[model samples]
Target: MKHLRFLNKYFYKYKWWIIPGIFFVVISNFFGVIPAQVIGHAFNLITENIQIYRLFNGFERATVIYDIFSYSLFYFGMLVLILYLLRGLFLFFMRQTIILMSRHIEFDMKNEIYAHYQKLSLGFYRRNNTGDLMNRATEDVNRVRMYVGPAIMYTINTAVLFILVIYAMFSVNVTLALWCLLPLPVLVLIIYFVNTLINQKSEQIQEQLSKLSSFVQERFSGIRVIKSYVREDYTKEIFAAESQGYKDNAMGLVKVQALFYPTMLLLVGLSTILTVYIGGIQVIDGAITPGNIAEFIVYVNQLTFPVTMLGWVTTLIQRASASQKRINEFLQLKPDITSKNTESARLKGNIKFEHVNFTYPDTGIQALRDVSFEIGQGQFIAIIGRTGSGKSTLANLIMRMYDIDSGNITVDGNPLKGLNLNNYRNQIGFVPQEVFLFSDTIKNNIAFGLDQVTDEEVSTAAKNAAVYHNIVDFEHKFETMLGERGITLSGGQKQRVSIARALIKEPALLVFDDCLSAVDTRTEEEILRNLSKIMKDKTSILIAHRISTIKNADKIIVLDQGKIIEQGNHEQLLQQNGAYAEMYQNQLLEEENQSL
Candidate 1:
């Protein structure tokens, strides 16, 4: 119920449709209940006339009874036909308006979740699993749609029909009506008790489903590792365990429902029996006519179905409530990163990091500590470091992937925080260590960032990255569709394609975070030579572990333990005989040994 309040805006948005849909529901119930009264009246009219006919002559009585019977049947049949027809029409409109509106709201909700995900920072993704997020966006959203659609429709139908039928019963005989409603308070109490259990069970079922989804998603993504390790049977066992957990939770919910629905029906049955007893006594005393008993029975039957349906409606509400709580938790999250100032400006190549320090969230390990550096416009700078030396973290900061703990990063003398995030990011080209390509055409993958790009531009970028020959050798050239995560390409080929993706942007600042790790030294050199020509008038930051890769840069910075240890060219570092020189000698020896 609390979760439903989050949807008030959507209800308001579609009120034009929803309000009319509710009207149709009410009118449909009116038609549906009216038939019971008609049947009762037809019986009453026949019974009353039969008593009258007994007093007349044989021929007169026979003709009068026949005429009354025929007219009564004809009138009852016509009323039923008209009422049912109207009921069907309104039911159709109700579904068209309300049910369809729920579908539209579901679409809007999914898109909104995706849009919010885009705004969230990298830290959020690190904390949440892909499958769990996907479940919230898909399965949880569907459950909420049920709440807005069938659940709401049935609830309104049951409520309105209950009111009408109770009014009808009261009109017939107040005492009989009160007797029939005696079990109602007990029924309400039962519903209230079962509701708590249903909500708890539903929440458990949804959580288990999320866990199962996450397990399956992780297994599929790491299938290669599972196969390589020959752990298929072991993985199957793990999956079975997860599946059984979900099944057990679902069964628990089913058991609660099994108890809930039957109890409601039993209570409704008791009410009917009570109605028959009280109404029979009234008829025997001649205080009310037989027609009153007949109408009361008809109205009681009408109430029975809806009262039973109340249990099902409650089930829908509880399930949807559980799912809505999950979705609301995500929707309410505010991203730590926000573009507060909208003053947009194009970036220049100069970048300065002043007293920057950052620690990874959740784990208080310092990834960077008072790190400071400056790159002049169009300067080619290189960063070399051991693993976990904060090299990649530095590049991430320049990209503003994470806000610094204490520092100011400026581009062209303007603070990074003050600039429009999108405008600032648009000017930078980044090729991360782990390259990711969409399941799209080679050309589309390379031109992914651009709104409109010419084929010639794509070809030129591919050629610059030294992947043009590989593309041409493929059956479809640039139009070749890649497999998931570019699995169709070799490691080096994927790296080169990623490089081409960034190169096509022709950004003012280009950061290659160990992007050439997969390519051989000879091929890496060739690519670097090509990049040097393109980056002559652009700022380039190359982060890598290989000394040979950054030996020829205008400036080289060596980091150790999140702090800069050495800063100089390759020859200058060798002259100093520091950590960089030691690493270079060690790598050179490893290459020589491998050759032997």
Candidate 2:
């Protein structure tokens, strides 16, 4: 219930529906209970007229008595029928308001979770799995909806029906009504005990379901790897084991629920038997008439269904409580990364890192330490480093995916943190080492960053990235759809397509972080030539391992570990005989040897 308080705002938002829904519930039950009174009256009418029929038998006046009997029966019959019809109408209205409100709340909640998922920092994603995130938004939300809809509806329906029916019974004969309700308090106590077990088991089942979904998601995504390694059987065994655990937990709850229903049937049947026995005694004593006994029986039976629904409603509530707790866990989180400024700025791309320092939050590894660099507008700078030498970290910092621990990063002489995060990110074109593309057409993938783009612009960007020839060769050309992560394209083709995605933006600061590792050196050279012309007035930063790729950079920086070991133009680094010169000589010798 504490966790469920989070849903109060949604309830208030849809209050018109809820308010009217409750009204319909009360009205429906009010009409539903009146049928019992009508039945009692019809019984009394027949009982009272029996003497008149006996005295007027076999005579013409007896025809008048018969007409009276016929009209009385017809009147009572029609009244009961009309009452039931009215009850049915209000029942329909009750569902329309309450059930429909639940769907709207569900829509709002899913959108909320998805939007928050996007706003969270990278560390949050690293700490959570996709399946768990998806489960909380979908499955957990569904359970919560049940509580908002059917559970609440039934609970209120039962309560209203109980109240109307019980009051009618007591108004006629209090002592008989009291005896018939003996099992109700006992039913309440039993449901209280059963609800606890339901809550505990429900949480376990949801948790296991999340694990199962995650296992399936990962296995499907890596199915190619599994086939290549021939580990399909092993994965199947693990899946079977997980499925067994889920089934066992589900059966546990089902067993408890299974025992619950029969027990409810027995208790409800006891009330009916008590009404027949005790009311029979009352009628024999002349304390009430036989019609009164018949009415008592009807009242007990009317209360039957609501009493039976008690266990079910409580079970749903317990499960929903468990699920809402899970949902509230994620909803309560505040993202660590937020923009200090909200104003958009046109960037000139003069970026400076003043002794920047950063450590990965998930891991204690410091990716950058005391690193400093500057890139003026229209400068082409290249960072060369061994693997894990803080090159990618520099790119990440420039993109502001994570903030620095100490020191500051400035763009166009303004603090990076002082710019609107979304506005700042929208201006930069960043191509990471591991490229990701959507399962969409080639043209759409190229134009993904923009809301609207011309097909001609897409083609021009592809031509600049050196992937236009490959695309044209396809039967569908730009309209050809890609598989997940662009798996349909070859490695180099995928890299080039990724480059086109960034190139189409024509951004102020364009970064290529080892994004050209798949293409041949000839293609790389051709693309680099195109970049020189297109990015003449923009700030460009290229992080690569190949010496040939960065040799023509305006300024070259070489990194080892987390520090810059050498900095200068190609000639200056070669003359110094430092790490860069060694890498250049080794590459040159390797190329010469390969020619042999």
Candidate 3:
């Protein structure tokens, strides 16, 4: 119940619909209870006429029969029909308003979750599994809708029906009503005890389902690896184990329901038996007529269904509560990275990293230590480093992916924190080491960064990246559709397409983070030559492992073990004969040996 408090705002927003919905439900139940009294009166008319017929001759007996048919039969039939018609009408409106409101609320909640996901930082996604997040977005949202729809409606239905049925029974005979309701307190005790167990089992079931979804997602995404490793049987066994756990948890919930429903029915049966016995004795003692006893039995029967439904409604509430708690956990998260300042300024790419130090969260390992560098506008700078030398970390900081532990980064003399984040990012075009292309047409992929782009712009960017020739050779050319992550394309083609995506943006700052690794040396050189013309007035940062890639740059920086060891032009570094010279010599020797 505490977990449901978050939904209060939605209820208030739709209060007009909800209020009328509740009124219709009450009216339907009011009409539903009247049928019992009408049927009881019909029985009384038949019983009295039969007695009168027995005391009369044939003509008089025929007249009593005719009277019964004319008065009791027609009146009772018409009243029952009218009551049922009104009940149906109200029930229709109840569903139209309340159930429709629930669907709208579901739509709004899902969008809210999606918007929150967009605001979350990259680090949060790295820590969470894709399948788990998806389950919280989809399945958990649906369960909350059940709470707003059927659970609420049925709860009101049960309450209104109970009150009206009890009032009707008390009107007939008070003592018999009290006796028939003896099982209610016991029913309440059962619900209280069983509800606790249901809540626990329901939570366990949802947790297991999330685990199963994650397991399946991982297996499908890595199916190629499993086949190459010849671990099909091993992976299958693991999946079976996860599936079995999910089944066991589901069965546990089913077991609780199995016990709960029967116990409810048993209580209802006890109340019915009590009504029949007590009302029969009262009629036999001449304290009440047969019609009174009949009506009492009808009222007790009406009470039976609502009482029986109590167990089911309790289960729904418990399950919905468990799901709400899971969903609220995600909604409550505050993003680690956000733009605190609203000031906007255009960047000229005069970037400076001042004594920057950063340690990744939860690992305590310093990814960058006192790293400092400066890049002026329209400079061609290259960074060469061994693996884990914080090359990518440097680029990530520039993109504001993570905040530095200590020190400041500035763009165009303005502090990075003071400038608006989106405006700052829009000025830079970045191609990461790992290229990710969406499942869309090649034209769309090239123009992904801009909201409005022409086909001519896409074509020019592709040609500049040295991929247009290959694309034109295909049957569909620019309209060719790509698979997930561009799986259908070669690695080199994907890298070129990624480069084209960034090029089309025409950003003030361009970064290529080992983006040309898959392309051959000749193709890489051709692409870089084409970029030189376009990058004449734009600042460019190129991160590469091969010495040949960066040897022609205006300036090169060499890093090892998260610290800068050397900085010079291509010829100056060779003259110094230091770490950069050693890497250049090693690469030359490897190339000479491969030629042999």
Give candidate 2's total backbone clashes.
Answer: 0
TM-score of each: 0.97, 0.96, 0.96
Taking the tens digit of each residue's C-alpha lDDT, what string does model 2 give over 81-176?
999999999999999999999999999999999999898888888888888899999999999999999999999999888888888888988889
Residue 427 displacement in candidate 1 (angstroms):
0.9
Lowest summed-lDDT stretch of 10 residues in model 1?
52-61
Model 3 worst lDDT window (10 residues)? 52-61
Question: What are the Cα lDDT values of the candidates?
Answer: 0.89, 0.91, 0.88
Which one wins on lDDT? 2
lDDT of 3 by residue, 1-596 (tens): 99989999999999998999999999999999999889888878878877777766477567867776677789898999999899999999999999999998999999999999988887878788889889989998999998899889889999999899888888878888898899989989989999999999889988988988888888887887999999999989998999999899888889988988898888888887888899889889887778877787777777777777788889889999999999899899998778977666766888888988888775677888887888888888899989999888788888888888998899888878677898888878899998999999999999999999998999999999999999999899999999878987999999999999999998889999999899999999999998899888789999999988888888788888778788878999999999999999999999999999
TM-score quality measure for candidate 2 = 0.96
Highest-scoring model, TM-score: 1
- The collision pairs in model 3 are none
Candidate 2 regions with alpha-carbon error over 4 angstroms: 47-67
Off by over 4 Å in 3: none
Ranking by lDDT: 2, 1, 3
Question: Residue-wise lDDT of candidate 1 within 1-596, one digit each (tens)?
Answer: 99889888889999998999999999999998888888877777888777777756476567877787788789898998999999999999999999999998899889998999888889999898888999999999999999899888888888888888888888878899899888889989999999998999889888888988998899888888999999999989998999998898888888988987788788778877886788789989876777777777777777777777788889889999999999988889988787877776777788988989999885788998888888999888999999999999999888989899998898899888777889888888899988999999999999998999999999999999999999999999999999988988999999999999999999989999999999999889989999999988899999998888999888899988999889988899999999999999999999999999
